[model samples]
Target chain A: MNADFLLKIDALSVSFGGVKALENYKLSLPPSRILGIIGPNGAGKTTLFNVLTGFIRPDSGHIHFNGQEITRWEPYQIARLGISRSFQNICLFGKLSVLDNVIVSCQIHERTSFLSALSKTRAYKKNEKALREKAWKLLCVFGLEKHADRRAMTLAYGDQRRLEIARALATAPKLLIIDEPAAGMNPNETQDLLDLILKLKEKFNLTIVLIEHNMNLVMQLCEYIQVLNYGRLAAEGLPLEIQQNQEVIDAYLGDTNNAGSN
Target chain B: MNKNKHALYLMISMGLFFCAVYLLDAYGNHYYQRVSNLMMIYVILTVSLNLSNGIVGISSLGQIGFMSIGAYVSAILTLPPGLKEHWLTGLPHWMSTIQSGLFPAMILAGILAAAIAFLVGIVILRLQGVFAAVTTLGFLIIVKVVAENWMTVTRGGRGISSLPTYTNLWWTSAVAVITVYVVLRIIRSPYGRSMLAVREHDLAAQSIGINAPRIRLLAFVISAFFTAVAGALWANLIGVVSPGSFYLWLTLLIIIMMVVGGMGSVTGSVFSAIGFTILLELLRGFENKIAVYGISSIIFAIVFMLVIIFHPDGVMGDREFSWDWFKRITPLF
Candidate 1:
């Protein structure tokens, strides 16, 4: 079989003060697919994302992205290498204008240096103009062009979440990881976000790793699903297969159902 | 809106400023000339410090250390061989003979400060918040102690005096304008945006491919360069270089100027520098009349207290003063 996966993780483990947050985790992800990671709180789903994105260093592991070993790369290096992520909580540049939030992210691709900027060289002006155009186009895509001059913190909560996604996409990533994007969103907003996520993947040719608690949305969008429980993989399979898996039913849904009945 | 109109406006303003400086140089009284020089020096110092304290969001109190380094280096470099022979008698043979012009010495001083800042930032930029600030404060103390005790190099606390006083109004104003232009360019650059992003949220910035530590280090080094240049110019203007001059009192004055001017606004920094210089000069004149020695300190304390109570964000509050303000006003026919 061809090693066609865009990302492959092997034997990843991490511990905090003798409490293993993640242990012996493994994954193989192909490109341009929506992969969902689901589990109860403290089940290490976000921990895995953190390690994958370089916020946390695992005790032991190897992660290969785009066929390059990336386990030891810094967060910024990993981001530059084509991985971008949105936080579980909205983390927009709150004091900046909505347009500037996207412009700063788009700056990762800018070629001009400090000297060029200081000189106000033709190249710097052209690059800055192009970047602004690109950022405006991105705002148009997310229906945020009207709010371009407003501060990010002044945006509505749903708009803030969408803005975070827009900022992430401005990096022009090959892989986009979104953590709890729909958490504070209403059902109507979540529905729109679901459509937006699917549209972005298609439009940008992006592979997506989504961590969400909204089961219906997850089941509808993800072709593959991995369920973690207490720092271990409880089940990994097709969405339907994971839905019917006995262990997942026992560890996650079973607890929820028991609490509901109580 | 067009580039040519903008350039023309800039040229007109710059031309006006140059005319004013030439007039001052030609006919202004000694007191007024001295006041303007102090204003320009303060503008350079405060604006550079604001790059770290305001843009990069690091409250660094070690600026005096870099300033002392620049002042001493430039003074030693530019001091006449006869003067060096008269004072600082323990100096090495080559050092006693070596002398350079003020311009090269100023540049060398800035380069040395930048080099030292780069090395120091590598270790301390990793620290966050007050921990980093305290470490910098410690750095200031260490530099001061070294300047005091290193008798061979600094002439101990006796300090170097009667150096060439070559810093005229033209030099100070030109350097101040250049400093402002360079800082504004930096703020509008991508690296500057990266530094601002790091200031906003370091983790978020890093996750987006902005290296926070490197951005901070760059800002620190750039700030050190400008600050050192200001100090070199100051040393030349006063014809004196003393360890006692660049102390906590000078640091406090600069920091207060930054705060009162609006910590993050370049225009505010310039305004505050000019305003405070004039205010201090007036207060000094008043003190001389009344035989009151510490009235200026009292006034400074009162001003700080009132600003904190009424307008803690300072005058401009992170906003730039732009040509748009002028463009918005139409002349009544």
Candidate 2:
């Protein structure tokens, strides 16, 4: 309760083509903490992410970030307000180098002055210099300095996941939202990803939020868990409470032997 | 391996290139100067189109619409009543304050072009992918229709004439150089990257903090502005204007320039601008055929298909032919 809450959503709702995707939903999130969201396929989990991140415009709701109302602010505005995200599908620019992919985040660091742009001033060059260094450092931090100049698409699946995290981290956000970071990874890769997340959370003092179907990773990694079913907030509490919460079990994992539940 | 060294060398080469151009123009005949002038304006036009066509991945066939605004606006602003008296023969009231100078008129025309583009960009950039390109084409048709119907200003079918031609080789080349620099700087900026990301993956860019629609709109308007300036210079060069000057043929010719040079590469655009200018000159055999839009359409199709097939990367590929890249590829050459 004493933790600094970074994001708070109130009664968020959205409809896509007459299908009510998200109904009245509300949640408050704290900083420097890991929040896990789990739900069935159509339970509006991604929709919730979209609404909070400015992708989906809620019909009736408010999104507050750091105590300021950011309900209707644009995506870039929300980003510049110190929010960053990784996609469910790894979204690195396949054509560009890993270095260039991360450097694109540098665009956020400086506001791309019109005068410097039109006239090609020295300030533009200085900004590029700073960006190049920052991009390199971020890549290095992810143990990817050796592969800086390689095409992003050429990276191994695990490296690609790490690269995505690195690119997101380049935004220098106070809060980081990752969608399925451990997705499509082998056990070794998932462990590596989990370790990287821990290392990064400590290093950047980052508040992390993610959507994960990997309950093992979710329960182990997340401090707080929110479960959704049918676009409603079914449960919100610590990880153990979510584990025992019967409704969460029915929606997320369903009635089973919990084979991957180990 | 320092990229800064390459940047420094490029700066030096540009300065030298300017000096060379100054010497040649200062001493050479008018004919050579005129060829250079044509190249300069084409450079501006083609490179600007690349902003939308290449960077944003929008193939705008309506580039001529924005160009027409610049040409007509510049012509009306600069052409004296004595000169344009026949063209504006049936002028309405309260039209006497119009000036007949070149630079002021060109500047005013550029601003007006951008303002109009800004407004139109709002409606036009609302579209996406192929629909966006198609809507802009429709926009060009609308501009053409307006210019033809507004007979008092655009001279309808006969077109406006007797404009004070103030565009010289020096001015055109300088504007071309600066325009390239301006566009390059823009493409390198965050807005440019966001626009590129929108082209690459719109949903991804959006989730990562880019507002795709707004970024696309900015590129669209800026592209329109520079395209209009090129048209203004073009009007000055020809010393005449006609509603028929911009049409399907002209649009095809401009598209050919951008595509043949490589869609988004600034280097490709400049090279293709010059190459396409020269190609157009060679197509002088089809000057008569161009009136019916035949020659340009054929040329555009052939060039576009060829580039898309054999030279998908355009003339320079995606890489620029800078001193550094040149040196890197020198061994192969």
Best by lDDT: 1
Give one digit per residue, the lDDT tens place, for model 2 in A202-225. Answer: 999999999998888998999999
The segments of candidate 2 whose C-alpha lies over 4 angstroms from its true place after superposition are: A1-4, A120-123, A254-262, B1-35, B89-99, B283-303, B328-333
Q: How does chain B score by TM in each prediction?
A: 0.95, 0.88
What's the TM for model 1?
0.96
TM-score per candidate, in order? Answer: 0.96, 0.89
lDDT of 2 by residue, B178-240 (tens): 788887877777667777777777766765667777777788778888888888888988888
Tens-digit lDDT string for candidate 1 (B1-333): 566766887899899999999999899998888889989999999999999888888769998889989999898888899888777677788988988887898899999999999999999899989988899998899888988888867788888888888998999999999999999888888877877788888888988888888999999999999899988999999988778899899899889889988877888898888888888988888999999899988997899889878989888877887666666695420
Interface DockQ of each model: 0.80, 0.50
Scored against the true structure, residue A28 in model 2 reaches a CA lDDT of 83
Error of 2 at A225 (Å): 1.7
